[model samples]
Target: MKPRILYLATADARGHLMRAQLLAHALIERGAEVEVLTTSDEGATFLGEFGIAAEVLSRHYAVQFDERQNMQRGATDGNVARYLFDPRHMLRDIWRLRRRIAAVDLLVNDSFHPALLVMGCLPGWRRKIVHVYGASLRRALLDNFQGRLPNWLARGFAAAISSELRRARACLQHDFAYAAPARVAPRLFNLPTPIALAQLPQQVQGPRAAVYLNPHFRDPQLATGLEQGLAAMGLQALLVGEGYAGRAGWTPRDPQWIDAAAHSALIVSAPGMAALSVAQVYRRPILLLVTDQPEQRSNAARAADLGLVHEVVCWSGDARLFAIQVQEALQRLRAVAIEEGADAGSQRARQRLDAWVDCLLELAAEPR
Candidate 1:
């Protein structure tokens, strides 16, 4: 019988869901039965689209931010206790998952707190695989270095993670780094693969541009200016992904936006892995908008350095200048034949994804 695998993920952003969906697809393709446990409705819907079963485990409340983009004081206080120690809720949810857990041969956790806790409770189940993405690992390391807790407390946390690491069958690091020679069974790169050229929609041809607006950033002036500028350039711009909900008159045009990207000449967006992966699969040149997040900045820089994209437009200040730079980037991309250059990057990305699938298959075959 094929191994039954349970995937645990926290859907703080679309990137998490996207990664889970991709990995689940890879697992299913290799004859494993996969079920995803996520923390958001959006994630559930995304998984459903791929025919993967998903159960929602938690809902994250938004934290308000100030003009400087920093979290406002007292904004998170209201939710802290519930987020940290809601045992009743956690236990109830775990009970729901208990039967499913008993049926699965292996568990694959992708940085979900409750799932991590559950894994710790499973004493003899040493076949758990933990997938650590770049952002969560960086956060853990930074928290340790910042002296955020007392020395004893810090050591305790470190010991807990170290013990978990030893128990994990394998650790899949999903970022652009050379695989470590030791300390893990199979080290795999975490990057999306390109869709097969023959499988891509034939009509998805031409020069197109994409823009991802995150409404939570609270920069209406910036968003308005960007939309107007893209329209002025007569470039076919596609906007996908959701911003904050409940904002006055803010409805996402995701369907139309997705269609636009598939047929556009160049794609422009914030450095979101999901968006970038889609653009790459469609063979579009991406113009990335840099953000405050370090991982995004790193992805943008690496993309530029690798010639996988056209340019990175940093929105530090001067909205007018930023708009001008975006326009110029679009013009440059429009002049090139994106299809001709897509081969190199697409092939490398596909190989990496294939290797990840192979690693997962090997783990599934191991004696339990």
Candidate 2:
């Protein structure tokens, strides 16, 4: 029988679905039967473009954030209250996933109900694998340490999760620019195959830059100001995101944004997994915006430290400063072509990804 792999991921964010799609494509090429179970219709639509089969496991009714950005805590108190009051909803979804687990040779999770639910229950459910980018439980622990949870409580929670981490056959930590192993598997990013890029929409000819904004905590005035500033810089900006339908001059596009990023001179957005992956693949200089979320803040810091991004700005500053910084970064990017340096980086990233895929296949081929 052919090896069958089931991928479980939250579909609310584009990053998770995109990564899962890329990996699924790779698995298919290797002759594995892959099916994705997600929670959003958009995710299913996006995956459809890749010719991947996606099953909608749950319909999420919470506040939808920018598909390109991570949702911040306390940003929607009512929504959070609803979730907290109804934990059984998530548990029920897990029960459904568990019913299908028996046929899966491997289960890959990327921050979804499956990881928190199914994996915690089956204990030996297939060979569980986790692909983590930004904003994980570790970052959460760091961010929530000072609150009502005492040190012992926090430590205990961490320990429990850590044990689960060990249970994973492999943990692929995708840092965007590069992946590092979290525990069992070496770290790796899901690098785009040249064929994948070729399959994307043809690059539009223009002085274009890709601007990504998370609509979750976005201040409309700030976004408008930033967009205006970019336009003033004489570059045609492609704003790709979930929200902002009424935002002037913004165009709606689908999965093609990944292709658009390949041709962009620069990419401006919070340091998200998908954004960072595009930056690394195309060797584009990044103008990173720090979000209020601690995990996102840490990701921005890490991107700056790695020399992958050209400039970093936090949203806490005044509008004037934000404008000035955006312009300055654009100027710097114009003077320097970071994409030229990405060839070597891209190769390195690809090798790491190949190794991870190989490890998975090898493990599956071995006798249980």
Q: What is the TM-score of each candidate against the true structure?
A: 0.74, 0.80
lDDT of 1 by residue, 129-164 (tens): 555555334444334423656878877767665656
Candidate 2 clash pair list:
179-187, 180-187, 181-187
Give the Cα-based TM-score of candidate 2 against the true structure: 0.80
The best candidate by lDDT is: 2
Task: For each of the candidates, give the backbone clash count.
Answer: 7, 3
lDDT of 2 by residue, 109-155 (tens): 76634334336434566354544434443455444544647888877
User: Scored by CA lDDT, what does every candidate get?
Assistant: 0.58, 0.61
Error of 1 at 142 (Å): 4.3
User: Global lDDT for candidate 2?
Assistant: 0.61
C-alpha RMSD (angstroms) for model 2: 4.2
Alpha carbon lDDT at 83, candidate 1: 57
Best by TM-score: 2
